[model samples]
Target chain A: MKSGALRASVQLSRSTFTLDVDIAVAAGETVAVVGPNGAGKSTLLSIVAGLLVPEAGRIEIAGVAVDDVAAGIHVPPERRAVGLVFQDHLLFPHLSALENVAFGLRSRGVPKPEARQRAAVWLERLGVAHRAGARPRSLSGGEAQRVALARSLAIEPDVLLLDEPLSALDVETRDRVRSELRTHLAGFAGPRVVVTHDPVEAMVLADRMVVLEGGRVSHDGTPAELTRHPRTHYVARFVGLNLYCGQASGSTLDVDGGGRIVAAPDEPVEGQAAATVRPQAVSLHLQRPEGTPRNVWPGRVVGVDATGERVRVEVESEPPVIAEITPAALADLRLASGDEVWVSIKATDVHLEPA
Target chain B: MTTPLPVRVLAAVGFAFVLLPFLGLLQRTPWSQLPSLVTRPDVRQALRLSILTSLAAMFLAIVLGVPLAWVLARTHIPGRSVARAIVTLPMVLPPVVGGAALLFALGRNGLVGQYLDDWFDIRLPFTTVAVVLAQTFVSMPFLVVTVEAALRSTDVRYEQAAATLGAGRWTTFRRVTLPSVAPSVLAGAVLCWARALGEFGATISFAGNLEGRTETVPLAIYIELQRDRDAAIAMSLVLVVISLVVLVALRDRWYRVQG
Candidate 1:
C-alpha cells in the first residue's frame, strides 16, 4: 500500500436509480467530482468514505483493500479512517471547536491532554485558534466551515471527502474561504475528493475533474483538458467553450457556416466529432486582415453578456460562436450588439474536428 | 347585541360552571378543620405512600422510555410503525384495564409469575411493588409520547457530526441526544410523576387499598368521601394548594418544553 492512493469501482442499485463508476487518485492530489443535480457525485464520495456501501464493487484506500467481494471484507465508516466535511458544516452545537477536533483523537486511544494539544496546533495552523471555545451556533457560516475542515484534517485520515464545502457561504465569502481551504488542503499529504458543480471551483481547487452524468462518468481528465475540449455538451457549456460541428482534413477545416479553419495534424477522427474553442481565444477585427491564417468568419454580434470585466459576445455566423473579450478590447474594436465584424483566429486557436 | 351572542353566552356559562365547584369547595372547605384533617395519622400515611411509590415509578419510567423514544425517532429499522403502536398502547388503555393486564402478567396465578415466585419466593401482587407497577403501567406512556415528539422534531445533523468526530453510538446518545432533548425529558418526567401521584383505580384494584401500605392519597380520599365528607373536602383542598404552588414555580419551564 502506498502512502495515499485510492482505486474504486462503485456500483449502487436502488429500485429507481443505479450508479456505477470507476475512479482512481494518488497522494497529495485533489480530484473534483463535478456534475448536475442527481448525478451520483455525492453518492460516490459517500461510498469512498464507507458511509454508503456499493453492492457489487471493491474499494481500496491506500491500497488497503477496504472492500473485497471474495474475501467478504467490508469496513464500516467508523473504522475507515476517512474524514468527511459536509456541505452545511455539520458541527456539533454542544461541543466547542477544540473539543470537536479532539474527539477523533480521543477515540483512537490518545490521552485527552495530548489530543487537545494536537487539536490546538491544528486550529492554529488553520488560523482559527481564537474560535476554539466557541460553539457552532455562535459562529458565523465561514467560521463554522473552517472548523469543519480543521476537524477533518486533525484526524490525519488516509482520504478526505469534501461535499460542496464553500456552497453554503455567501458569494463574497466563498472566494476567500476557498483560498483558505486550498491552503489547508495543500498541507495534507493524502488523497482528497471534492464534490462541486461549479466549474470555476473545480478548476481553482482541484487538479483533475471527473464529469458525472446519469450516475456515470462522462469524462475524466485534467482541468486544462476539460476546459479546452469538453467531451460532452454538458461539460462544453459548463466550461464556457464554443462548440462547433465541423469537418477536418489534412490541414483544412470546414463547418456548416462557421466558415473555413486550420487544423493541427492530430485533429479528431472523422464523423461527428466536436470542435470546441475557448471564448477568450477568438479575436475580432473590423476587416479581414491580409495575413496567412486559417480562419476568418463574417458575423453580426447578436448578444453581449458582461461577465466580470470581460464581455462575452454571441456572434450569429453559420454556426453561432461566443467570443470573450476584455472591456478594453471590446472598446478598441468598437463592438456592440448588431455590429458586423470579421473574426480571425490563428491555426493554433482554430481547433477542428469531424462533423 | 347588548347581551352578546348565544354561543358566547353559552361558552362563558360553561366555563363558570366548571370553576364554580372548585371555588365553592375552596370557600366551604372548613378552614379551621384543615390542619387536623391533613395531620391525622391515616392521612399522613396515605400522602407519604403516594409520594414514595409515585416518585419511584416515575424514575423507572423515564429510565426505560427515553431511549425507546430516541430509537423510534431516528432509526430505519423494519416494523418501526408496529413498534410505535405497541409503545402507545398504554396511553389508550383504561387505568382499570391496565391494572388488570398487569395482574395477569405478574400476579401469582398469572403467566411468568408462578415461576418468579417458585424460584425466588417473591410475590408481586398485593405489595408495594404492585403499587409501583400499576402506577408505572398507567403513567409511562406520557413520558414516551412527549419525548418521542421532541426527538422527532430535533435536527439529526448534530448526531452525524458527532459520528464523524469519532463518538460511538452510546457516547453520542448520552452526551448529545440526551441534552438536546433535556427540557422535553424533564417535562415528560414531571407529567409522569403527576399522573402516577394522582393514580387511584389501578392502585386500589391491583395493589388493594391497605392503610399505611397501598392506600394512596387518591384512594384515601375516596374512602373518606364515603364516611366523612368534611374531612375529605379538607384533604382535597390541601392537595390543590400543593399542586398550585409546584406548578407556579415551574410554569415557564413547562411552557417552553411544550412549545
Candidate 2:
C-alpha cells in the first residue's frame, strides 16, 4: 500500500439535497474541493474524517478500509489516523498552546514530558514557539489557527483535511496564513484535502481542483485546466470565463440561445460540448471590425463594473458574455448600462470541453 | 427617570417579603451568648455531622450526576426529553415526599430494601449513610441541571478536533469537555452542597435525627427549638452566617447570569 493515499465514494441523501461523489488523492497531492455554500464540500471532508457517516460509502485511507458499509467496518474518528482542522480553528480554550498541541500525543499514551517536547517542536515548526504558554483566548486568530494546525499535524496522520482553513482570518492575515499553511502542508507528505470557496486559494494551494455543485463533482482537473477551460457555470463565473453550452458540428458550435460560435480545430466534431472564452478574448469595438478571423455580434451593455485592475463589461447578447477590458479602455469606450456595443472574439482563442 | 409609584411599591414589598424574616431572625439572635450556645456538645456534633453528610452528598452528586448530564446533553438517547424531566422531578417534589419515595425504595422490608436485608443483612434506614442518601436525593438535581445546561451550550467542535487528534471519547470528555464546563461544574457542586446542608424534611423523615450519628444542624435546630429557644437561634445564626459567606463569595461566579 502506498503512503498518504485516500479513495472514497461518499453517498448521503437529505430531503432537500443529495451528495454522491467518488474522489481520490494520491500521496503528496493536495486536492482542493471548491464549491458554493451548501454544496457538500464540508460534508465530503466530514465523511472522510469519520465525523459524519455517509448512508452509503467505502473509504480507504492508505489502503486501509476505514469504512466499508458492506462489511460493516466503520472505524471511529480517533482510530482513522486522519487529521481535520475545522473551519474556525476550534482550539481548546482551557489548554495552553503547547498542551493543546500535545493533546494528540498524550491521548495516544505518550508520557507527559515527551508529549510536551513533541508539541513544542511542532509549535516551533509552525513558527509559534514564542506563544507556547499562552492560552487560546490570549492568542490572536492567526496564532490560534497555527496551534490548531500544529495540533492536527502532531498526530502524523495519513491524511490531512482542512475545511475552509483561512476563512476565519481577516484579509491580511488570511493571505499570510494561507501561504504559511501551504508551506506546512507541502512538508506533511500526506493526501491533503482542502475545502474552500475561494478560487484563488484553490489555485494557490492545491495540485488539483475539484469543483462541486449540487453535491456532484462537476469538474476535476489541474488548476491550469480549470482556469483555461472551466466546465460549469459556477466555475466559469469563478474563473471569469465566458462559457457556452451547445451542440457542435464540424468546427461550428450552436449555443443553446440561437447564437453560433466556432470552436478550436482540435475540439470534437459533433457532440454536446462547452466552449469557454476568456473575458480578455472578447474585445469590445465601437463598430464591427473588418475581418474573417472574428465572430462579431451586436449586444447591449447591461451593466459595467470595475473588478480589480480591469472593468468587466456585461453584454446582453443572445448568449450573454462578459468582456474584461482595461479601465482605460472602459473610459475610452464610455461603456455604461444600456449602451449598445459590438463584441468580437477570435475562433482560435475559444477553448472547448465535452459537457 | 423616576420609577412608576406602583412598580416601586411592588418592588419594595417584594424585597421586604424576602429580607424581613432574615432581619427578624438576626434581631432575635442571642449574639452575646452565641459562643456558649453553639459550644454545647450536641450542637458541635450536629455541625460536624452536617458538614460530613453534605460533603458526602456533594461527592456522590458529582460522581454520578456529571455522566448523567452528559448522557442527557450529548447523546441521541431515545426518550431523552422524558429522562431529563424525570431527573429534575426531585427539584420540584416536596422533600418529605421524596423521603417517602426513598423509604419505599431503600427502607428495611421495603421493596428493594427487603431483598437487601434478606440477602446481605443491610439495613439502610436510620443510619448515617441514610442521612447522606436523603440529602443526595434532594440535592443531585441541581448539579445535573446546571452541568447539563453547560454541556448543551458548549461548542462540540473542540471535541471533534480532539478526536481528529487521536483522542478517544473518554479522553475528549476529560481533557476537552470537562475543562470547558469546569465553571458550571463548580457552580453545580456548590448549589448541591448548599441544598444538602439545608435539607431538613427529607433528613428527618429518613434518618430520624439521631444525636451523634445522623443529626445534622438543621435537624438539631428543629429539636432545640422545642426545648431551648436561645440554642435554636444560635444554631440558625451559624447556618445563616455560613450560607451567606458561601453565597456571597460565589455570587459573581455562578449567580451573575450572562446574556
Candidate 3:
C-alpha cells in the first residue's frame, strides 16, 4: 500500500479573516501544525477533516479527492474515514466508555460482540481498560481523552485529526500523556495531523513540523530547522531567541532598535531582515571583559528567578536580553537583581532572516 | 414554626387551589343518590364514550405530533416555521372556532363530506369519530411544542459521533435519539391526554352531543346540572378525581416529581 497522501490547499474567506494554506502528510507520518492564537491552524485541520468545506481547495486524502467543488466531489465527514479528536474530547455523555469506543465499530457494520472486543483492545492499549465501563462524566480528563482516542481508532480510520490533544492537561499530566500518546501513535500506521500552540508538544510529537502565521506557511521544516532560524517574531519567541530587525552591511551592523552589533558577512539578507540570538549564547561577566566577541552589551539586572534548575536573569541592556545560567554559575558569580553585567556572545549564534 | 416562609406560603396556596375544591365536592355529595345516579344507563354510556374518545384522540395526536415536533426541532426547511405555527394554531384557536372549521371542512355539505357523500353517502360530523377528531385538534399542539423544545435543547454532537462510528441516520435516531428524548415525549403524551380528556366545546359543536353518540362526561355533567343537581355533582367529582389521579400518577412515574 502507498499509505496516505493529501495535496489539499484549503482557502476560507470570512469577513474578518481569510484562511489559505496547503499541507501534506504521508502514511504513518505525524505532521504538527503550530502557530499563534489566530494562525488558522484549527481551520486547516477542519478543512482536512471535512468538517468545513473550504471556499476553494482540493482535498485528496489517501488518494481520494474529497473536496473538488467543480467536480461535485465533496465527501462528507462520515464517509471520509478521517477521525477527529476534539479539544474537549466530545465523548458521548450517555454512553459508557466501552460503548463509546464500540460505537465506531457499530457504525462500520461490525457485529456487536466483535466491536466490543476490538474496542477493548484499543482501551487496553491506551491503559484505560479499567475505565471502559464508566461514563465520560465520571472519567478524568486524561482518561476521557484516551477513550476518545480509542473511539477514533476502533474504526481504523485512514487519517487521525488531533486538535490540541495535550493542551487541556495540567503541566505534569501533559508531559506524561504526551509521552503515552507518542507510544500509541508510533504503533498506528496512518497519516496523522496534530495541532498545537505549544512548541514542546509539536517538537516532541511530530515527524515534520509546519508553521502557519497570518494564514500562510511561513516555514516548513523539521523541529530543528525552525529553532535554528526563526524568520518571524512568533517563532523567535517560541524558540527563546532574541529577534531584532536592522541593516547589516559588514562586521559592524546597526540594528533598528538595539544599537549597533557585528554580524558575519556570510549571513544571508537581501532586503529588510531580522537577527536572532539565544539568551544562552550570551555569556555574562561581572565586569566589561576585553575580547573580540562580535556582540557584547552591558546592563543592570532587573530581575532574577530560578526556573527548573537554571537561574534566569532579566537584564535592562540595549535590545534587552534574558540570560539563562546554571545554578553553579549563579553561585560562582554571586548574581543579584541590581548587578551590572556585560553580555558577550560569539558571532555564529546570531541568525539572520529576511523580514 | 421554623419552616421556610416561602415553602409554607406555597403549601397553603397550593392546597387551597388544588385540593380544597375536590374536598368541597366530596362534602356536598349526596351519598345516598350516588350509586343510582352512576348506575343509570345514560351516565354509563357517557362515561364509556368519554374514556374511549379521549384516549383515541390522544393516541392520534401522538402518532402525528411527535414526528412534527422532531422536524421542527431538527430541520431548517423554509416553511418549517409556518408548519410549527399551523400546528399550534389549534392549541390557541377558540374551541368553538376550531369545531366550526372542522365542520366546514368535513361536515355533510362541506368540501370533504360532499365528496364522501357523493361517493358513499358518508360524512364525519355528528358521529363518535368526529368527537375524537375534535378533541385531538384542540390538544395535539401541547404535545408537539413540549417535545420540540426538548429535542431542540438536546446536544446534537452525540448524533454526529454516532454517524462517525458507522451508524446511519435512522439507526442513530431509533436507538440513541429516541432514548435521549424519551422523558420529553412522555411529558408531552401526558399533557395531550389531559387536554383531550377535558375537551368540551369542539366535541359539542362538531360531534353534536347526543345521549349515547356524542355525550361525553363533560356534556353529561352539563345537561344534568340543569335537570338533576345531585347526579351532576356526583359526575363532576368523578371527572375531577380521575384527572387528579392521572396527572399525579404520570408526573410521579415519568417526571420523578414528588407529591
Clashing pairs in 1: A272-A355
DockQ score of candidate 3? 0.38
When just chain B is superposed on the true chain B, each candidate scores a TM-score of 0.91, 0.95, 0.89
**TM-score of model 2 (CA atoms):** 0.90
- Candidate 1's docking class is acceptable
By DockQ, the best candidate is 2
Question: Candidate 3: where are CA atoms >4 Å away?
Answer: A170-172, A251-271, A279-350, A353-355, B1-15, B29-56, B79-82, B111-122, B210-214, B227-259
Ranking by TM-score: 2, 1, 3
User: Candidate 1: where are CA atoms >4 Å away?
Assistant: A14-16, A244-270, A279-350, B1-21, B32-36, B74-79, B154-157, B241-251, B254-259
Question: In CAPRI terms, where does candidate 3 land?
Answer: acceptable
lDDT-based ranking, best first? Answer: 2, 3, 1
Q: Fraction of native Cα contacts kept in each candidate?
A: 0.37, 0.90, 0.47
Query: Measured by TM-score, how close is model 3 to the native structure?
Result: 0.81
lDDT of 3 by residue, B1-259 (tens): 6999999999999989987877888998999988898888888898899999999988998888888889999999999888889999998889989999999888988879789888998888989999999999999999899889989988887776666556677878876787777787888888888888888888888998788999999988989989988888888877887888988888888757211
**Among all windows of ten consecutive residues in candidate 2 chain A, which has the lowest summed lDDT?**
A261-270
Those runs of model 2 whose alpha carbons end farther than 4 Å from true positions after fitting are A248-254, A257-271, A280-307, A311-318, A322-355, B1-9, B255-259
Q: Report the lDDT tens digits of candidate 2 across residue range B1-259.
A: 9999999999999999999999999999888888888998888999989989999999999999999999999999899999999999999999998888888898996899999899999999899999999999999999999999999999988888888888999899899999888889999999999999999988888888788988999988898899999998888888888988998888676655432
All candidates' lDDT scores? 0.82, 0.89, 0.83
lDDT of 2 by residue, A1-355 (tens): 1365899997998565699989999989999999888889988888899988888889998888999888898898999899899888888888899998999999999999999999999999999999999998899889988998999999888999999998888888988988998899999887999999988899889999999899999999999988877777899888778899999887788999779888667745678888888898889888878886558888899888895788898899967899999999988988889988888989998876666
